[model samples]
Target: MAILKQDLSFLKNNVKQVDAEMFTSKIRGIMDSHAPQTSRTVTDRTSSPWFSVESKAVKQARRGTERKWNKSGLEIDKQIYLYHKKQVRGINLTAKREYYNLKFSEVQNSKDFFNLSNELLGKDKNTKLPKSIKSELLPDTFGDFFIEKIEKLRHTLVSDFNHDEDFDDSQSDASTLSTLSPVTNDDVKTTILSAVSKHCDLNPMPIYLLKNC
Candidate 1:
């Protein structure tokens, strides 16, 4: 905040010399210096709701036992590991059944029921057309289809309503806006502040930073 205030003060003093482009560059520089960009990896995978702490603990134990058996190569250790693995599978199945039963019992409406069903069937995944089908010509194809439909509908409507009437112009009056109130600095500032705070790649700085300024 102090850095921003100092930079903004300097900018204010040199405001007359700064053109729109120069001002935008200066603001963008300040923002970049203060808050640099960072990159991260993201995944769409989600953990199962039915996988409780007990299930995780049992799974972890099974893994540990399996590791111990692998190291020792003893019959007893192998049997223990196998027992733990069986227990894990059984616990997971029971937990999943209980989770689904509770969810089903809690469903209060058809929407909720359908949502749950879709979730269970993995039908809730995002639907996207293949990239191969999304060519520049696709938009033209859609436009042509709609246009043909519109033309056919227009012809049908025209044939159905055969009677035509003369245009009415007596009620219409010609009026011109001779003057408009000048937009003040306050109005511009208000408009900028009121706008949605969504950042664009081509923008000089984030809308949040502009609002702060």
Candidate 2:
């Protein structure tokens, strides 16, 4: 943070003259210098969202103990491994319970409540249509259906058409949006502050860092 502040202080004098692209590059360079990016491969298997660092540590310890028990074939080692295994299970259950409890408390509407309920019940799996579905023919099918319906409706309307009916323009409501108010400095600040703190490859720095600076 101190480094960020110090680097950003240099921008005060040349803020007006600095080009947008150059400014972005400079900020990105500073960020990369302090926090270099690293890559990791993702797999299909994922950890539970409720799992914490403590749970991971305990699980790792359990694995170590189990390995020792397997190697030594000692009764005491087996008991210690069992103890750690139970601790991991208990921690996982407690974490899951607390996580769902908090989620249930924060639900504001029936839709959200039902969604959370489905998540808890493991019923929120992605829905996919069968491969046998003739999706390629759907556009033509939809076009034909709509065309036939519209043709029938058009014929019915023609039979019931009243050409002598007079329209009343005065019955319509009047509305006009001639101008928008200019955005103020406070509005800009508020928008930046309210923006999500997510960072992407294109972003020079995270919004949280921008806010702090």
Task: Give stretches of model 2 more than 4 Å off.
Answer: 1-44, 125-213
- For candidate 2, write residues 76-175 as lDDT tens digits: 9999999999999999999999999999999999989998888888895576644654989767877898999999999888766754255565776878
TM for every model, in the order presented, reads 0.44, 0.42
lDDT of 1 by residue, 100-178 (tens): 9999999999989998989888886566555766677788877898999999999988876764345465676978699
Give the whole-model CA lDDT for all candidates, comma-separated. Answer: 0.86, 0.87
Which numbered prediction scores highest in TM-score against the true structure?
1
User: Cα lDDT of model 2 overall?
Assistant: 0.87
Residue 46, model 2, lDDT = 88
After best superposition, candidate 2 residue 206: deviation in angstroms? Answer: 30
